[model samples]
Target: MNLVKRLKICVFTFALLFIGTAVNAQITNDITHEEAFTALLAAKKNAEDSNVLVNIAVVDAGANLKAFIRMDESYLGSIDVAIKKAKTARYFNMDTGKLGELTQPGGIIYNIELTNNGMVSFPGGLPIKNKDGKIIGAIGVSGGTIEQDRAIATVGAKSILE
Candidate 1:
């Protein structure tokens, strides 16, 4: 009887594990190249009104660069920073504003500021999500004030709205 009970428990545990994996498998979202490009273009267009050169980066949920754009004669040196910030937002699934709170003078993110490939924890990065609310990617803007960067990031991410 003891052996039989153990076998039954094992079977139940396996079934539960299988079900959990299946449910979680559907939670990840994938962003297409087209979507990424569109987001970058939108960001650039919106920034034209400000006439400030900006660098934009679109990163996958894993913080991988999916696409990027740099305005002509922009600093050109800020590209890496832009990519890192976007990756930071993609990995955290939050806007850079909240990230700033965590990385502020004595915040949790302060100690690990360089955790994401030396990405700066500034307020120009925003995560991109799909209609299903799954974070598919992130967008980052640099070369302007933090607020301006934030605005560009917002419009860039929202440009993908269907």
Candidate 2:
């Protein structure tokens, strides 16, 4: 082949290789088992520090349960609530409390809680985000008042960033 033709072929081959490699380099964002455990521990610690008994739950990017803990003496009613809260955060990519505000009467998403197999529109759930600010999972806490639950859940979600 002529010199110019050979050079053109070489450049084309390099471009093809680069494109293939770039496609294969795509990364998936999800929470690891260890990270979920760390978040649960942080939430539990926050509950203990506040002298509160609570149920904590962690869910992955797909809103699937990863870890759950119910402190001794915690209200039994909070079991499902904790899981739902985590799912709610992951589903909406925002805090459950914020959803509550938006779903209230006269709000933009009024009555939205009636959908999605039933969502908790109250406090206690937060989305866990990666260093790039992409949500990778969520944390939820229940068995306490709204404020207490929100506080504990916030601590758990923040742990993943630290």
**lDDT top scorer:** 2
Tell me the whole-model lDDT of each prediction, alpha carbons only. Answer: 0.85, 0.93
List candidate 1 stretches off by more than 4 Å: 1-28
Pairs clashing within candidate 1: none
Global local distance difference test of model 2: 0.93
Best candidate (score: TM-score) = 2
Tens digit per residue, CA lDDT, model 1, 50-138: 78789999997777889988889877777987897798887778887787788877786575666645767788999998777888999
Q: Number of clashing pairs, model 1?
A: 0
To one decimal, what is the Cα RMSD in angstroms of model 1 from the true structure?
6.0
RMSD, every candidate, angstroms? 6.0, 7.2
State, as a TM-score between 0 and 1, how close model 2 is to the true structure. 0.82
Candidate 2 ranges beyond 4 A from true positions:
1-27
What is the C-alpha RMSD, rounded to one decimal, of candidate 2? Answer: 7.2
**Model 1: how far is 140 from its true place, Å?**
0.7
